[model samples]
Target chain A: EPEVTQTPSHQVTQMGQEVILRCVPISNHLYFYWYRQILGQKVEFLVSFYNNEISEKSEIFDDQFSVERPDGSNFTLKIRSTKLEDSAMYFCNSASDGETQYFGPGTRLLVL
Target chain B: SQQGEEDPQALSIQEGENATMNCSYKTSINNLQWYRQNSGRGLVHLILIRSNEREKHSGRLRVTLDTSKKSSSLLITASRAADTASYFCATDLRRGGADGLTFGKGTHLIIQP
Candidate 1:
C-alpha cells in the first residue's frame, strides 16, 4: 500500500533557530495535514493544506508556522523560531478526500 | 479542548481474549476513525465509521457508532499478542473543510501471550 513519507526522522535544533519538516504525500492524495503530539498528550491538529492553500489552522499554528506545497510531491512545515515547547512528534498525513488520513512515521523535533 | 475522549485508559488481556475500547465525543462528527500505534511509531489506521452508519466490521475488528449518544466502541475479537498497542479514536467534524482529525488520549492495550 502507498503511504505518506517524511524526511529527517529525527531532528535536533537550537531554540530560536528555524526548522523545516518535509513530507511527500501519496501521489494521488488531494488533501494534506500536519499534527503534533507532545509526550503523553493527545494528537493536536496544526494545519491543513489543499490546492496550495491553507484550509484551517489551530492556535498552536501561530505566526511562527507556515506550510508550503513547493512542488507536486513535496509539502513542508517551517517554524520561523523554535521554542522549547515546540518539541514534539510532528506527523504528516494525506487523504484522497478529507475523511481518512494516512499518516507518516513522523519526525521527532527536539529543540534545546 | 479535545474532541474525543476514550474511557478505561488501559487494558490487559490474554492472547485469545477479546479487547474493547470506548470513545465519547463532544460534537457532531462527519465520521469517526480508530487508529493503532506501536510504541514510538506512527499511527496506523484501523477503521472508520461514518455518522450515518451504526456498525461496521473488518476481519476480527468491529466498530459501532451511536451518534445520538455521541459515543463509539471498537472491539477486537480473539486478539493476538501483536494487538498490544495504543488505540485512539479520532473525530472529523463535518463543518471543517480539511482541517484534519481530533484525536483522544488513547487506550493502551496489552495482549499477553
Candidate 2:
C-alpha cells in the first residue's frame, strides 16, 4: 500500500535556528495535516492544508510556523526560531477524501 | 477540548487473551478512528467507525461506537505479544469535510507471554 513518507527522521537544532520538516503525502490525497506529540502527551493538531492554502490551525501554530506544498509532491513544515518546548515528534498525514488519514513515520524534532 | 479521552490508562494481559479499551468524547463527532503506536514510532490506523454505524470488525479487532453516549470501544481478541502498544482513539469533528483529528491520551497495552 502507498504510505506517507517523511525526511530527516530526526532533527536537532539550536533554539534560535530555523528548521524544516518535509513530508511526501500519499500521492492522490487532497488533504494534508501536521500534528505533534510531546513525549508522553497526546497528539495535538498543528495545521491542515487543502487547495494550496491553510484550512485551519491551532494556537500552537503561531507565527513561528508555516507549511507549504512547494511542489506537487512535497509537503513541508518550517519553524523559525525554535524553542526548547518545541521539541516533539511531528507527524504528517493525508487523506484522499478528508477521512481516514494515513500518517508518516514522523520526524523527531529536538530544539536545543 | 474536543479531544477523546481513553479509559484505563494501562492494561496488562497474558498472550492469547482479549483486551478492551474505551474512549469518551465531549462533543458530537462525525467518525471515530482507532490507531496504534509503538513507542517512538508513528501511528498506525486500525479501524474507523462512523457515527451512523454502531459496530465494525477487522481481523482480530472490533470497534463499537455509541453516538448517543459519545463513547467508543476497541476490542482485540486473542491478542499476541505483537499487539503490545499504545492505542489511541481520535475524533473527527467535521460533519462533512475532512478535518484534523483530536487524539486521546491513549492506553498502553502490554501483552505478556
Candidate 3:
C-alpha cells in the first residue's frame, strides 16, 4: 500500500533557529495536513493544505509557522524561529477524499 | 474543541480475550475513525464509521457509532499479545472542506500473554 513519507526522521535544532520538515504525500491524494503531539499527549491539528493554499490552521500555527506545497508531491512546514516548547512529534497526513487520512511515521523535532 | 474523549484510559486483558474501548464526542461529526499506535510510533488506521452508519467491521476489529448519543465503541475480539497498543478515536467534523480530524487522548491497551 502507498503511504505518506517524511524526511529527516529526527531533527535537533537550537532555539531561535529555523527548521523545515518535509513530507511527500501519496501521489494521488488531494488533501494534506500537519499535526503535532507533545510527549504523552493527544495529537493536535496544526494546519491543513489543499490546492496550494492553507485551508485552516490552529492557534499553535502562528506567525512563526508556515506550510508550502512547492511541488506536486513535496509538502513542507517551516518554523521561522524555534522555541523550546516547539519540541514534539510532527506528523504529515494525506487523503484522496476528505475522510480517512493516512499518517506518516512522523518527524521528531527537538529544540534545545 | 472538536476533540473526543475516550473512556477507561487504559485496559489490560489476557491473550485470547476481548477488549472494548469507548469514545464520546461533544459535537456533530461527519465520521469517526479509530487508529492504533505502538509505543513511540505513528498512528495506523484501523476502521472508520460514518455518521449515518451504526456499525462497521474489518478483520477482528468491530466499530460502532451512535451519532444520537455522540458516542462510539471499538471492540477487538479474540485479541493476541500483539494487540497491545494505544487506541484513539478521531472525529471528522462537517466544516466545508478545511477540516482535519480531532483526536482523543487514546486508550492504552495491554494484552498479556
Candidate 4:
C-alpha cells in the first residue's frame, strides 16, 4: 500500500479568501479523489480525477472549486473563494484500480 | 441524490461483544463498502459486498448487502478497544458512471475495555 501524506495538516483562512490544499507522496495511483466532511455531517464527495482530468464532481464543487494534478504527481484542490460553510476536514485519496481508495490523514480547514 | 443513512448514530459495547451497524440507502447500487475512521483521522476501507453477492468478510469484519431492501450491515466480532471509531457505509450507485461514492452519516462506535 502507498502512503498518502497531506501537507499543512491544518489550514485556517479568512472567509472570501482563496486557499489551496494539496495531496502528495503519490506513487502510481490512477484515480484521485477529494471529499469533505463538515463537523457533524456526512463525508461528501467533491470530485474525482482520472487520466489527468476531472472525471466527476458533485454539486458542491461549484465554479469556485477546481482540481489539478499539476506536475504530474501533486494533486491539489483550490477554492477560489472560501466560505464559513467550507470549513471542514478535507481528505485526499488515491486508488490504483479505482475501487479501493486509500485516504490521507486529512487537512482540517477552518474559515473564519 | 442517493444517500446512505446509518442507524443508531452511536453505539457502545464491551470489548468482547459483537458490534453491528446497519445502513439504509435510497437507490440502487453496484456495491456497498464499509470504512472506519479514527477520531480526527482519515478513513480506512474495511470491506465491500456487491449487490449480487450477499456477504463478504475480511479479518474480523463482516459485511452484508441486501439489494431488495437497499440496506447493508457491518458486524465486527470480538471487538477491542482499538475498534473504537466511526464506521461508515458507502454505496457505489449504479446510476452514476462516475466512481464517486455516496456515504452515510457514520455510526460512532465505542468499545469499552
Go through the candidates in order and give each one's C-alpha lDDT. 0.94, 0.95, 0.93, 0.89
Those runs of model 3 whose alpha carbons end farther than 4 Å from true positions after fitting are none
Residue range with the least summed lDDT across 10 consecutive positions in model 4 chain B: B90-99
Top-scoring candidate (lDDT): 2
For residues B1-113, write the lDDT of model 1, one tens digit per residue.
45799977999999999999999999999999999999989999999999999999999999999999999999999999999999999999974379779899999999999
> lDDT score, residue A80, model 3?
100
Alpha-carbon RMSD of each model: 1.1, 1.0, 1.2, 1.7
List interface RMSDs for the candidates, in order. 1.4, 0.9, 1.2, 2.0
- Candidate 4 lDDT tens digits, A1-112: 5688897799999999999999983598788999999988889999998888899899999999999988877999999999999999999988777777778999999999
Chain A (candidate 4) TM-score to true chain A: 0.96
DockQ: the better of candidates 2 and 4: 2
Q: Which ten residues in a row have the lowest lDDT in candidate 2 chain B?
A: B92-101
| Model 4 spans > 4 angstroms off | B95-98
Give the B-chain TM-score of model 4.
Answer: 0.93
- The sequence of per-residue lDDT tens digits that candidate 3 reaches over residues A1-112 is 8999998999999999999999999999999999999999999999999888998898899999999999888999999999999999999999888688899999999999
Sort order, TM-score high to low: 2, 1, 3, 4
